[model samples]
Target: MATDAVKKYLEDTNRPYSCADVTVNLRGAFTKSAIQKALDALSEAGKIKCKLYGKQKVYAAIQHDNADGPSENEDYDTPIKTTTIELEELNTQLKTKEASLKSLLAAPTSDSARVQAGEIKTNIEKLESRLATLRDSVEVMSADEKRGILESHAKLLSEYKKRKRICSEMIEAMLEGYPKSKKNFLEELCIETDEMVDFKLVSFQV
Candidate 1:
């Protein structure tokens, strides 16, 4: 007749907790005939509380406040309490709230209001287009004036090609003077600096 065995039976609602639930968990010293006797003993000891729901009489364990204290039903501010909320009631509330939220979000805004909003967006986009065009014209004019002032800035690739040509001529002259034959330039350049082809990899940008 352990209090702990009765406590386990009352806590889990999914399992069909009964006298069998107690006896099976206890394993020893608890026989089928003794199941009723255990419940009676726990009830008489005031270590259990029960509530009626539908056809089932659900029991819960009561915690003892103090050894010297009177039973939990005494005039103490804090007494042992157990709450069993009805599943049906909770389910009904959940469905009602779900329906209400669905209705609220699904309801359409006023037709006139939506049209006005679209018109306002169109006006904003038109203004932004004009602003962008004006900005582009200003940048082009500024670039032309700067180009006129600084003709010193030359194309970097033009100077690089000229230098490469001069180097090649000098290298050919030196190699021609050597008695040994020069290595093939075509095979080395083809393998080392081949042109890049189209390819893609995973990337993200702002």
Candidate 2:
């Protein structure tokens, strides 16, 4: 489906389009990676032509005329591939295993075999739940939302590192005059927010 969307978008456009441009236009429908995959597929199918410009890959739709002959790769439209339903088969297998496990659990007395069956059932349940969660996520999640979350996490980590660096610098300055062996100095080095604040205030006075 994404490949078809990409083809259509390129067909409508007069100039070449980059993966980022296609991804932005598609937005919630497909991710940047997905768009690139589609672009690769289109290139392979000869529906599009790719040219490298510096570090970027740009794609242009192949033009064809009704009266003209076909190129090496036919420039005719093809059916858009749809997502497969292999997950349905997995669900059926999981259900069968769950029923068998239930029967084993209903047996009169506990045995090693039953214990193994229970463990198997727990594993199956975990796998089934995980697959279901993934399916749901794929259906509802957007690439932009995921990127935003990642960007926020990276920003927080950057700020944390900067703060730690400032504190380390302040602590190292404070110990400049202390007489101690390098090993002992490194082992004793510790930096805290209050100490950093004090160091900044002292620096201001000097």
Candidate 3:
């Protein structure tokens, strides 16, 4: 009976849930191990889909040929809400970093300018790391979910390109102003030159 209810819940929602999630959603209607058993049985019977997301197992209700997948009445936004939030956050951080970089570039070179440049570099590195993480997260999403996120974020993608162009220009400016040693340092960091930085890899358009 609990297994049927669990299957119904998955079918109605059309989303994946971890075992812990299933236990919480069921709210003591079934023991955690019991729910796990049901999920295993469902997977074996082709009644549900089960896969590992990282180290954790997740289950989603299987959609049959005749069954409706996502209904017209269903909330489409619910599926990619986390991705939306992440993109918004990334846009905000990118904007902040862009402003900082612009400001750093506008100021005349001084000890303070060098320190600001270092800080900007660190922030950019962190942003790149976040971008790589976002890409990985997107890869895990279903094709439709990934398409939805990319379509909704077209403007964000444009902003990224604009910012990349700005950064490239700023790097050229820095190379012109800084000594040879600074150029060597940048090369060692694999940045090499302003022209060498491949903006396409980080572009959301890609």
Candidate 4:
């Protein structure tokens, strides 16, 4: 019964779906394992199509007449294009905001601007004191020790950037057919980007 239901769903939709997607769309009519088995049987019987994209397997109904139709991967690629454009727009906005912030900090004409400037000054004094304490507690290092530290920092930074990139791509893919904008989704999840925190990853000179 699940096999028939899944087969009919795929044929009617004529779109690719992952196992998790099928399970969610089915409204829990069948267990995920049962749905997966149905998908696999249909794929093996040539009633449906299955392809591995990255680590995930996606299935679609075989179309006989629509040979010139869009590829299944287009569903994933379309979101990526939209997300890229949105990111570019957001970057432009960020630059404008940064310039405005610099102007406010330099002038401090309004009450809010003056308060913010004062807070920033306090933060700077605290950071300077912390840095002095740290410097006093640390001993001078040899050239070899300094080089090793720099090499370790570089390796960690590379891994961090790689992981962040992978995560961003995955999120972009997941944004397909999502109801809300990427900014709203991230806000709901309380996720912060590097730009939000004014953080940047830079290579350490060894």
Candidate 4, run of 10 with poorest lDDT = 72-81
lDDT of 3 by residue, 27-82 (tens): 88999999999999999998887766446677888656534655523343444456
Clashing pairs in 3: none
Least lDDT summed over 10 consecutive residues: which range in candidate 1? Answer: 75-84
C-alpha local distance difference test of each model: 0.57, 0.71, 0.77, 0.85
Residue ranges of candidate 1 with Cα displaced over 4 Å? 1-89, 92-132, 135-139, 142-157, 167-206
The model with the greatest TM-score is 4
Give the RMSD in angstroms, all C-alphas superposed, for model 2.
Answer: 31.1
TM-score (all chains, Cα) for each model: 0.27, 0.32, 0.34, 0.35
Let me know the TM-score candidate 1 reaches against the reference structure: 0.27
Clash count for candidate 2 is: 0
Ranking by TM-score: 4, 3, 2, 1
Tens digit of per-residue lDDT, candidate 1, span 70-148: 6543321122121234556778899999999999778766986799889999999999999899887845557666675
RMSD of 3: 34.1
- TM-score, cand. 3: 0.34
Ranking by lDDT: 4, 3, 2, 1
